[model samples]
Each structure stands twice: as C-alpha cells, then as structure tokens.
Target: MFIGVGVTIAAFYYYNNPVEGESCHIQKENNVAAFVMYGSYFYLFLQFFLARYFKVRVNADSDKKKKVA
Candidate 1:
C-alpha cells in the first residue's frame, strides 16, 4: 500500500514537471491519481472496518459474576 501511494505521488510530481514542449497530460494524470488515492484510502478503511465489525471473542466476558475463579 505504501509503495503504491509512493509511486502515485512520484507520478504526479513527474507529470507536473514534464519536459518543456512535451504534453504533460495534467488532466488525465490528475484524474487517475485522484481515483487511485481515493481507492487506496477506501480500501484500507474497509479492511479496518471489517476487522472490527467481525471481531471474535477469544476470552470469556469480563463480568464480575461470570468469573470462573
């Protein structure tokens, strides 16, 4: 994930600093970079959400009345 984001940032910088007289394709680059960044963030958020949402109980409940000892 970090590698992908790093590459996207590098590409954005390169597009903004293209060779003189060469087409930078800034519009296309911006669109692709925006979607890539958004997708990356959304994907990470989903993973964390799912992990918390489906957490399993490995230990007994912590109620004082429920103590086995």
Candidate 2:
C-alpha cells in the first residue's frame, strides 16, 4: 500500500536522523509505536503476498449474502 510505503520511507529518514539524541531505542513509547507500525505493515504485506501467490483469502471485501432493502 502507498501508506505503508510512505511510512517505511519516513521510518528510514527518522532512523538516519534522530531527534536530539532521542530515538525509538531510547524512548519506551517510541519503541512501542515503531514496533506496532512496522508489525502492521509487515503483516499486511505478507498477507498480500500470500493472497497473490497462494490463493489465500484472509478477508473478503464483499459478502455475497448482502441484500438491498
């Protein structure tokens, strides 16, 4: 996804340039936030790969049973 790509770019940029000696490794909250962001992106990309190459459907975008009332 474009969002994930953008986040990845931002992550790389920040990692290369820390804020006044503060960083994900030194800040507890920053570490947690970084982990969560990267974890989510990794999971999404992995699922996409599996779906594309292995015919795995993690989540359906539409329900066939839906009806207009």
Q: Using Cα atoms with residue i matched to residue i, what is each candidate's TM-score against the true structure? A: 0.46, 0.44
Model number with the top TM-score:
1
Per-candidate local distance difference test: 0.72, 0.67
lDDT of each residue in 1-69, candidate 1, tens digit only: 667667666667767688878876557657596767768897988899888888785655666547865
Error of 2 at 40 (Å): 0.2
lDDT of 2: 0.67
Backbone Cα, N, C clashes tallied per candidate: 0, 0
Candidate 2 is scored at a TM of: 0.44
Error of 2 at 26 (Å): 1.1
- lDDT tens readout by residue for model 2, 3-36: 7556656766677687895864444466457667
Enumerate residue pairs that collide in model 2. none
Model 1 TM-score, all chains together: 0.46
